[model samples]
Target chain A: MTGPARVPPAAPAASTAPAASTASTAADVDGDVGLHHLRLYVAGQTPKSLAAIANLKKVCEEHLAGRYDIEVIDLMENPKLAAGDQILAIPTLVRRLPAPLKRIIGDLSNTERVLVGLDIRAKAAAP
Target chain B: MPIKPAPFRPSLPKTPTGVAGFDEITMGGLPTGRPSLVCGATGSGKTLFAATFLVNGAVKYGEPGVFMSFEERAEDLAANVASLGYDLEALVAEGRLGIDHVHIARNEIEETGEYDLEGLFVRLGFAVDQIGAKRVVLDTLESLFSSLSDEAVLRAELRRLFSWIKARGLTAIITGEQGEGRFTRHGLEEYVSDCVVLLDNRVQDQVTTRRLRVVKYRGSAHGTNEYPFLINDHGISVLPVTGASLSYSVSDEVMSSGVGGIDAMLGKGGFFRGSSVLLSGLAGTGKTTFAATFADAACTRGERCLFFVFEESAEQICRNARSVGLDLQRHVESGLLRFEAARPSLYGLEMHLARIHRDLDAFRPAVVVVDPISAFRGPDLEVYAALLRMVDLLKSRRITGLFTSLRGDGGLQDAEDQGLSSLMDSWIKLQTVEANGEMNRTLYIIKSRGMSHSNQVREYVMSGTGIGLIEPYIGPGGVLTGSARITQVAREEAMQLHRRQKAERRQQALERRRAALERQIAEMRASLETEEEEAAGWLREEELRELVLKQDREVLASRRSAAE
Candidate 1:
């Protein structure tokens, strides 16, 4: 049974401008390309959670350009969402788009690990 | 530069494991509100220890427990513990325990995306909440590594898992497989855990011993040496090598030694009640018989006695004693005397002590007799330490104990060298004295601490009527026994016979002299009678010649005399 209700993220990421530019460029190039559906689960507005959100936006903008969408699921408000994603550690990012799903645990600060874990690019050498 | 010590904090509140000796060794139990790692090699009783902890917590300590097995199923775990007298299903049904089997077959599921162990956490949380459990056991926690492809994630998640339990304030024992030079396979759990307990199964001389050592415990003191643990129907228990403290209550009362005449030599009574007596003797020196006498005395007094025979079977002991008129069967039939006979080599000293303790707990006997205690074959120190602990345990209970040891050719001195004599409150030595081409059994009281006892060696006879101790057979030359004693007694009796014969000869001579004297007197009397007759005849003839002249005078005289 799903325990507790779903709630929206407490705040939106400040790096939305870069993600919008990247998404528009990618959308203009590939007509009706599928959008990346991403969910970031965090316990609260802790530093680790905020850092995860910022890092995910940065990664999406740089890698997926404008063809990605991010959903921040705060476990503090909707802990039952953790059960849906099988989240045990906090600041976990799950990719729910482009067929097979992928999960990256811990803060998304390690760009190489986050990209490699999500299988975005084989050995995505950090620039 | 001098290294600065870490700030020490008070020890964490412990959640008692309830498994025997764990509390005592760990100083209070497992580190509470945190994950403690129990790592061991294969067949080292890791799972059993964890299960016993959970079961004992639920049943013994009145605290509910949740057992989440990553390897075995709930039914399998339950069935396994059923042999240990733990009814897991019943406890589960009664809401005292929750056993959740987390199955992770490599082929069943695919790890396609990012996943945490939220499912396991939820189920564990549900189980704990269901029973209001204060303790949780994750058997073989390393099994989760097989299902995951991400090592870094698994390591981080495990760390998080440990801290998560700490945050929830629930004590947990996470079991793992041991690796070379590492307590666990991953070697990372110990770093995250608050404590690490290592269980080892070692085999030497075809004898397997399971030992437990507390490798690390944060903010607490723990036993450093490896302690042998035992698993049986009664459950798992660890044997602490050191015995109880010497400062214990002592019973002043005395009890009989049970041998025919041994009690008189043990002092006013025999050994003190609650005292431990060691009987060291060579082969065929009546050690078992002496032990039987102790048992008999207790049984006759209506006090329960427990006889632990290591070499002989109960039937054999009973039959052998009956031949010596010990009559142990009647005590057995009456239910006052109990015999537990087994080969001590069948198990380690810990298991033997565990079984003895179990029986003692059930029987509550006033006296315990361990016949041939040295039968616990092992290192001399091991056997001696085990015996010391046993004596300590019985002494603490204020129960009289009689322990017999098979002394070697070195005899009492050799047995005493093992430190057993010092541990005993009373010590008796029995030996075979070879004299006059015969072996005689003799016993002596070596020492009885705090009590006056006889120091003289007493020769004893073991017959159908049981053991009889006589004063040592001392003679003119030296101490003689057996046929030598018989010869001395016979020699003295012969000298007595010669003196009586001499007196009889003198009395016969006196009787002959008296007979002769009587015969002589009879002859003299007869001859005198004949002579008197002759004299009378002669006188008559003379009177006849004068009668012619005297006849008239005689007639006249006769007439005058008649008238007169």
Candidate 2:
């Protein structure tokens, strides 16, 4: 939780590049690194919510491949859950894993901003 | 069905906000079922106003409300307004109120592409439905602008929200931060066009006063002037004196002016009930004493009195009044008299007016006394305006108002300079006239609107038994008072005594002369009798001589003389 325990063996040296599809299967292993845990908050399955979910999945598949876990929470079904994440806008994406949490609002249409928002590219370039 | 003409309606329907004096200024409160924008600078009581609106609706009007605060949490808001006696938590627990705190941090989130405020809508809708709320407050919705960089989307969403609120027929209040030139930071006044109220906290001469004004009310007639308001333990109360109509019913009743002598000068034995009386005097001229006497008289009659002392504490006033034989403490203890004492510099004049208005509403006293109203140091017009409002407030309730003012310079002209005499129904000026090296108090009824008051100035004297007015002494020197009057009175009495003594002495001499003359007349009569006897004797002797010749002639004469 403090830091990435260890870089996943399947992950490429340059994590900025897309990891192999098999890398995501190793996310359950202990001490696996470069695994992204994201949670998307949505009120209902509106167009914006659907688009955010699709775009978030596409960004995850393209960037980290199988190295991320996306949990979609529908606030309409569970309105009480929205307070826990301090969600004010629909289609909010919260990065819960890798220590310091982060949030990005709106449909994840811009891949570059999403990558930067999740610190994937920064973590790779700096490491 | 036959076609029917629509009934003529003068104004838009209103939802009463239940805020004191506010509804009167708005004519009936805000336009019903529409969003009203309440904008003000920070710490200007915007939150309190909104909360009062919501809480009053729930507790008083049986209307449930939803309060969505973007700045303060539910508990904080509740705690903040608890001083106003609004049990927000109790209301919430009773299902009459719903408080949702929307926490937004600018640094907590990043905007990826496009988003709307549907999540906020969901929360607000849930709260409203949960309470069946007829009122809603979105306090500071403008915070979203700072949290999110997308102003275009936020503005569009706000417009939608307003329409949505209208669609549901919910009376909503949307508070915003005041802008440099506009009414609100984001110009929320533009979206909420039904009504807009602006609150202002102005500091003048290091004193702050809160004022409220209805900037615009579409299709409704509302007061446009800035009405001074107050935020105390009871919450925000607007003093809308201008809105108070002058048509309040008048009473033909007259009440005593406390002291019997002053009442005698009023010609009617008292002042007109529900009328305002001004007691003005120089320093130490017993102005407060007169006011306290009036209060004591009112309380003695089993009527309640409210005394607002700006110069002294209630205890001090009661104690001083006691020295003059006015037992005000007894009245206080009997709950017939109430004292509200505060420093004139404690707040602005408007705040004082609001506070008085609040107290009047609570106490509903039959008489109100503002001792030494001149203690309020401010622009003459401001003080005058405040006093005018106070007079109107008291008159409208048919409460007698006795206001005392300290006359500067102790001149007749100085008393009239305040421009307050015109507002009072009766003006009593107390002057300290220095005569014969002594200062004496004199009372003059400058004016009594409906009564033929005495025009003569009476010497005012305060002894252990309270105030009394002595008949002015118009001697050769003219209008003498104090020891000068006493001396003049004594001198006139001495002159009268001397005149009476001289007349008595003259009568005694004339009686003595009459007695002497009578005695002399008696003596003369006696002498004449003696002479007559001698003559008779001589006649007798001659007769005797004759009798020597004709013996009895003298004897006959003697006999005749003896018979005489």
Candidate 3:
């Protein structure tokens, strides 16, 4: 890739092989200009991973809905991909498009900690 | 060898690294289609070892390799390895080797997103495809740990990298710097790799020694001992110096000792062709001279001789040998003899042995002579065992060995005490005896296995032409020696003269007594004759008197008697 960060044999004229975070790649670049991209890492589709996904969706809808992108990654299919995000715990959520990378642990049950971690502004509370 | 090459392959095949002395320890070489970890402290020569392995693979085994360095650039590594005699530029130009220096500028990037090392894998795969590389080397795995902030990410990537390299069926070496508690800084790659080799640089008593040990080798038998390794222009050479067993075919052919006296002292008038000989002596004895004689004799027989002089220079030994009539210079000039002269303190014992082994391999000499190898005694070496390693190498090659050992006391028992006498096939001892206020050289054979050797201690004499043994001294005081022998001879002469004079005087006395007795007999015979004449005269006078006065009685009686 043209990006000097990539160590490739055939130099690409465009950025390639950059950190392929699932949320960053899936985020709608044109529409979500100011949108925050998020990634949730879990071992498998267990109760914890499913509960984490459901609670994160609920928080996104109640707070900054339609402005954020969330991508869930299962480590069982691709265990090696977890290392790129520094994931040591299962059911960990990472803010992929923020200025400073932030990590939250657990099943996202604590709404207050989750809001503080994701820097979410609640639409109902603000109106 | 793992299972005798059965129909079904039970394990991975070994690909020889071709580094000097390393393949022997690995049985054949590193496991093919597997990733091996090499970890050491800074300046422990890990990169050099890895580079040598790669270069040797390309040059010797015809297996092209890829070197992906994370720390130094391509030019710096190539230059460093080039100084060690590796033609990196040539190999790269020929497309047999690929050097990719991945510059990880830690300050240039901020981690705004997550990513896997798919880019690195792609580049490595391209390089592998470029040269059909069968081997790969990642010289600084620790740099990857520093470049990334997340341990989980780096560890996962490393595991993935090892598995990928294995999947590609290429042998790989990942080198890392040792950390305080972990085998490597990241501490997880060693678990992922199939084998782990640890390099250690230790300074004991101010002498630095590099040692290597294979911590783990999955499904392969390897030497687990801490082998002393030497790094130089020839790369890393590991000497398993103290291994209890080394199997080699032994030669029983006897070889001359060069000097007639020494040969006669040895069993079968010589030593086994490949056996090791130990010559131990005090200072001023004939150890060096005897060793020179052996070298000269070997050279004269048209066999190559490698003389490693730890005490003197080759020229000095040659010049000294001229006094003893050994023409070493001629053999040296004729190319039948080679000399590697250096002080024992010039290098650590490992380097010393490595140099000797390297030279021996290059020269392929039939006879190897180490003059006073005991000089290698220092803080960093177990000199006895180190000497045995040298001997073992020579024996394995079927090369004759002659080693000289210096003893503080002039006794062969010192050699035995040092345990060299037991290892050597023959042990000869030289002595400096202070006989008659002069130091004299005498030699004796302490032991010679499998043949009857001379037990008599022959006094070794150095002449202008050569060295030889003289008949032992004998005197009236038992074997006469030194000044006492001369004095005993003079006393014997004087006593012999006195005895001769006494015998002459007794003969003269007997002659005088015989002459006197003959004179006496002659005088008695003359007296008897004179008495007879007087008797006749008396008789005549008596007759006349008898005729006159006694005529009456004597004459009358004589006449009567006459008448009667």
Candidate 4:
């Protein structure tokens, strides 16, 4: 069951932005190309939860530009949503778009880990 | 003989070996319907761990188990785990478990022909059927190997036995004493089994560390590391060593070292909390003094402490403390400290463990001091296993454990004692150095778990008041002995006092000299002033020099005549 397409489509850099611009031009075309419709599942203001959010914001702004929309979902406030995602491990991140939806577990710091897990670099190669 | 009825074989369920940590290591219990192999060296807790598993299953878990022993009888097994808090009687009475002691006498039971495990299997099957048993334990399968000389028959029967356990869908734990380089003597039984657990009972430097390592688990991701397991009143407690690194956070809190100068030398001014320190030295190197000082500090901080005296009685301990100027009696009387004195040979390794477990449970002390764990060493490896369990137990409670090991003839660098050494979080070697013909006791903290302890051996002296750790002996031929340390410290103290006296004398002489110099300067200035006035008068009289000169001469001659 697919959810609503609240996340915006990838930035239309396919026609304009060159392949060489993947690293440098990623900052210029900063509109939901890299991690959009991202959902952060957490449970209250635990150190892990706070760290997860802080790490995500730092990572997103630095890498994903202002175009990415991060949905902070508190399981304590909405425990029912836990059933939909098979969330055994807490502080899980669900990358909705960039199809074949990847789920990255744990408080996603360790910059290189987040970069590789989110599959953002593959977006620039789309025809 | 014609009227003799067939022998009665009652229904029985397979028995479970209720070893405490063993079950946990197996995960959801040993293959619920298969015979698994438990192999270890002599006194590696192979039989004890296995029997405890069965007894625990029956007595605690309410799952009836049958234990068929080829070695020790029912009473022996019961008595062993009795210290471990497993009451085998209640379980037997409640019709839950059955203990069948099958003594296969080598001389008595003759193997006249090709023997089969069918007779033993029949006996076990009968026991299982009678109790509706869910678990079974066959201890030391080596006994069968010893009984039956043919390896081929033993292998066939063991394989058949494994199949019978599986076919019957009963969980079974079979134990065998480990052979050199082999998991079990009768290989196919343990080989075809679902799990293999290896137990090691090793002793080094008189401290025994019993470790359980899961060599293989077919379908589960068990803790593959050598987990330290303790067999006490409640049975085996496995200290999971796998995920230890993930749990630590660095902190900068300087805890007092219970002694003055020692703390001052430490940049942070103290040891860290949850740090294990070892004070190892020769018999007279004052290792106990260090432990007492630590206990004093812990007790003073309102944190409860446990002192396990191995070599001395509690009263003797108090007396020893008095000699060293540490009054532990007050703390003990005040209930802030608990002093436990027991000979290392007072009980089996497990009994010692049970006492420690019970004491820690009752007192809930923050610090535990095992004064001279080296006393637990024996010709056997059981002591080492017990020591390891004790260490693991302390670590789990996060108790700052201080263990004093008495290093005898061999110095602290003996690799032969690495069993206990590896388990230690921190190691301190105390050496009595003979420095400049005087006995000096120096303490060198060889290792500290999570903090950097002093490497240099500092001189220490205990007087009427308390332990006085002084500056490290600098002018030393090498490390000083105990007698030399005392003499060296006295000489150094005397030298310091002499230096102070000399300094005082120097200061007094300098003060007197300064006062005299000031007086001289004042007088010289006054004389110059008088001379200047006279010169001014002379300059004024220069015009009338002849007249002034004649008057001056007349005045001078009058003054001279008056004086005459």
Candidate 5:
């Protein structure tokens, strides 16, 4: 609004795409960093993906204090939200955060790293 | 000024540069994922710097790298850096890095043919893909220029290579030789590369200085000064001239040099940790003996010591110490001292640096000694560069480094060997000056970087016990070489033996000759007697004949003819 103000053209089809997926996954949401509203876009129930879900639950409880939600959306089951986040790879973590959403692409070995990347924890004091 | 607020976003993680003095100079390392061009004239250390970057990436930073050489063969490159302690072959086996050498033959190939350099691109891309390499080095891009005669195509290909490296988001190092009018081969890699580093190997007053300057590094700050660097077993280390002001207060501890007089020359005690000491002199001046004594002292202080004997074997060093009255055998036996013997040509300069670096890492020595550093000077500028690196590495670790140099005749008479003089924190000269009728052994401290040292040349004597510092002797002559004196003594002894043998041989010869002459005279006398008797007989016969002739001259003549 302040600078060049090059507003991106609205792609309305993407807005309606996530709403339909949310209805089917609504039963699983428990309000754990939007676990109720969360969608984990995974290709299949591969070991990498299972590890990611298990790791997410473990990290959320330890750090997020259960004030959030998570919705595991297997792309093999829905296969539609992949285009919504522009997901090119599998096992991506999408933050339906406090506002402007962010995505992390990897098999999260570093839980603290992933959490820090997702803005879950306070930014580390400048070392 | 008001305190500034911290950024809401987390700061990016920093990566470390794997070079020895380089990281310290830059205060960290080059900007991550940016290509840097290392340019220099022949033997100016461009390739060495690039290799150092790749090696440090793999070994130091725990990041795998790729080294593509279009000039030298991979085996030759490996052999060259083998002395620097970079076991690229082993690193390859461990799958931490990949080294591919592209030999561009000028004779067999035609440059006019349309070539795409796709093979090179594929090879580089494949290497990067295999290792997930964060660093890549192309050594001597100039060779490509000569191999491909099309200058316009070569220039375009070079630009493409640089762009491809950046597009891949890899930190690449492209090395080129500086031409007379060009900063790089293809004459333009410098403009495209994110950073440009120039290594200059120049002789100042007959002594060569290898200086590295960062010409330009885009979008990031860098040290723009020409830093002195050394190439040794450890590879290339740029000695940052910027950090001279970073000093630590000295401790008054009476550190011993192991030699009593040498230690006593210092008003209070001995050299401080990180203080370099130079022991320089001509041959037979007892520099090695002095170094051995220092190693012994460091060992006695309950500190680890590494003695690198370039001129003598470790066993010979132990034996020689006996004559000098300083026994280093006990330290070796106790495992307090580790002695490594090497001829400089045993490896390239970088290889030597690496060897020392690896040993230092293993032994973690508090004090290190390079006996007669001159022995390590190879027929290349790399030797001096390696020595500079060795000095930088030791100084950074706050370890005391002692170097003994066998000064040439001119080196001793002149100010100092320009190659070594500037790098020394403290230079001690052990010269055999001819005063009076004999040569005297004198030790003097020419320069001590951070401490006060003895200004006066101290006369010292070596014997079976140890070094004995003497008061300025007021004798008619000094006899230190023990060469002329020992020779003179040997000659007098030989003369005595010669005189005794000559007298005995003369007596024997005279007796034999006299006996032969007497025997000859006796034989001559015997012959004379026989001849005289014959003559007398003839005379008697003649008288008889005359008497008989009167009686029967005709009958005697007939009888004599018939008898005959």
Candidate 6:
């Protein structure tokens, strides 16, 4: 298990502030190949939201250190964005760059499940 | 501190659904600011019911609503309800309605560990605030159970979601799939304890009927009977058989029964206004003729009449009535007469009742006719129940109902009409009396309450002009009709003519006899007069001769005396 060193547990507020801009810019520069684009949706700085952000960063750092980008969206501020992604559960991780979009709900505490959900281990095993 | 009796809470507040007869059944509508569970089997119209509730709230009650569907897309939902005449797209465009489709694909969804439905709350909150909605619909929330793997978390979140909806004070309808025995598959009824409605679409003997029942209504008095509802071009209309009460106000006014002879027979000039009249007869006994005549009379009086024909089309009825000199086509063209024709087998008894209820509401006619109600095929008791409700509905509105029933060839006590007769205020029976090798139509009032009706049977005559009742002709052999009546009348006329001729001949004979007797007496008198003249002449002669003799004797005496 990788420790959540890349994202502090209390950094959801600071990370979600630039989430909208980061999501737009990342979609703008999507010509790069083999990049893992992830978006995490949350409501405010709840423990579940912060843990999901920290755990998702830690997992990305261990599995896809320099190839992944994480964008944290706080639905409390941008509630209208929830409907566009068909969001129903908080702390949902949406894999944006994948050809087939995928959603993993709940706090990303289990590193193995997150890796499998994002199809990272399969790519690593095949490559 | 003595607990001050909880402020004596009144009845639970409700939000009217605006569905026809549904508010009456629920005494208002679903509990206000509370979640209601609408559970039914697949194709049982669960989504339609939810959509109707939301749409009616937005359009009718002026309360904006939000519809969050889990099974169908927003555009698909709008298209599906468009047939019901709900312009959901327009409502949404006007900001009176908000539709959000929550697409949850189990294949694309991956469950990691723990999650809360705060995203759903946020979305609902946003939609509600956008429209200031007072009503919300979470259609088929049970889909979440199939999409997510964690039952415990889903259940907890569902409970919280209901509370959140309540906290917002929005009347919400959450639909669920029917379970094996419970109200819903996921037991959503346990969460929506304020109101639970169950819709059922059942097929019996190849006929499908939709029924709605209020399984449980907390703190409200709702109709306990299963109400048959209809989904037509309008929307859901629940037909509550027990919704009408017996305390409808009655009118003392009288209206014509269309046939003047029949009116004369009914002493009051016609049937009492708003009274139920049953015209029962065997087949070909002119039941439709009487019904059409009554409808014509109502239309002639400028009152609207609605005719429901189960066996014949409207044009056929009009054509048949034209043969009897009833100009019903004119009334139809004038818009005072309307006919609703359908085969009795097209719908079940309750469905027929619901359709009738809908028509009555739409037309609001002053007179209604159900021609040959016996065409309805069902258990006799079920038919009776439906008819009872129909009569109640008509009477409650004070609309005159004329129901024609076809009876069997049995005697006066027709088995099918036994239960219906008591329900009718007046019952006119038509019988076909076979006498003198001819079939004669006869009509009589079996029972006419509150009026002295003629008990004598009159021969029902249908001529080119119109229907008339030939007064009862009680000949030597009882009531004569048809050729027997004509023959009896002819016989009576011939006997009177012969009696007059014989009396005239006897008077002539007596006059001749008297004349002859007078002539004979005159002849006798003439002879006597002649004899008397002769005798007088003789006497005069004798007297002359005597006088002459006396004169001679006197002259002799005088000469003697002179000589002396």
Going through the candidates in order, state the TM-score of chain A alone for each one: 0.69, 0.71, 0.69, 0.68, 0.65, 0.71
**Candidate number of the best lDDT:** 6
Candidate 6 per-residue lDDT, tens place, B514-557, comes to 99999999999999999999999999999899889888998888
Model 5: TM-score for chain B: 0.56
The iRMS of model 3 comes to 10.4
- What docking grade does candidate 6 earn? medium
Which lDDT tens digits does candidate 3 get at residues B1-564? 221232344365777777665666776678888888889999988899889879988888789999988877889999898868888999999988998876554432234233455546756776788799999998886787676675676678778888899899989888989988877887854555578888999886567878888888888777898888877777667775555356988877889998877777766879989888888888778788888999999999999999999989999999999888888999999999999999888777876877887888789999999998778766323775677788888988899999897777754445444577777888888877676787767778888877789887777777886887876665544454445555776888899999999999999999999999999999999999999999999999978875688446865778888887
Residue A91: error of model 2 in Å?
A: 0.6
Candidate 6 deviates by what RMSD?
Answer: 5.6
Residue A5 accuracy (lDDT) in model 6: 24
- State in Å the error of residue B226, model 4: 6.4
- Across residues A1-127, which tens digit of lDDT does each residue of candidate 2 receive? 3433444323222232233332344443533445676779898878999999999988887776766777888878867666656778888897765444678898989877888888876766775
Model 1: per-residue Cα lDDT over B266-335, one tens digit each:
6666778998888888888889988887898899999999999989899998999998888899999999
Which lDDT value does model 6 have at B262? 91
| lDDT to native, each model | 0.77, 0.86, 0.76, 0.68, 0.68, 0.87
Per TM-score, the best of the predicted structures is 6
Candidate 3 has an fnat equal to 0.00
Per-model DockQ against the true two-chain complex: 0.08, 0.51, 0.03, 0.00, 0.02, 0.71
The alpha-carbon lDDT assigned to residue B365 of candidate 5 equals 93
Where does model 2 exceed 4 Å of error? A1-37, A62-68, B1-11, B415-418, B511-564
Model 2 over residues B1-564: C-alpha lDDT tens digits? 111212334468788888888887887787888999999999989899999999989988889999999999999999999988899999999999999999878776878887888878878877888889999999989998899898899889999999999999999999999999999988898899999999999999989999999999999777899999999898888877876768899998999998998888887889999999999888889999999999999999999999999889999999999889989999999999999999999899998898999999999999999987888888877877888888898999999999998877766566444478888999998898887799999988999998898889889889889998887898777899999999889998999999999999998999999999999999999999999999999999988787696656667788899999
Preferred candidate (lDDT higher): 4 or 5:
5
Using DockQ as the measure, name the better of candidate 2 and candidate 5.
Answer: 2
lDDT of candidate 6 at residue A7, scale 0 to 100: 30
Higher-scoring candidate on TM-score, 4 or 5: 4
TM-scores for the candidates: 0.73, 0.87, 0.71, 0.50, 0.48, 0.91
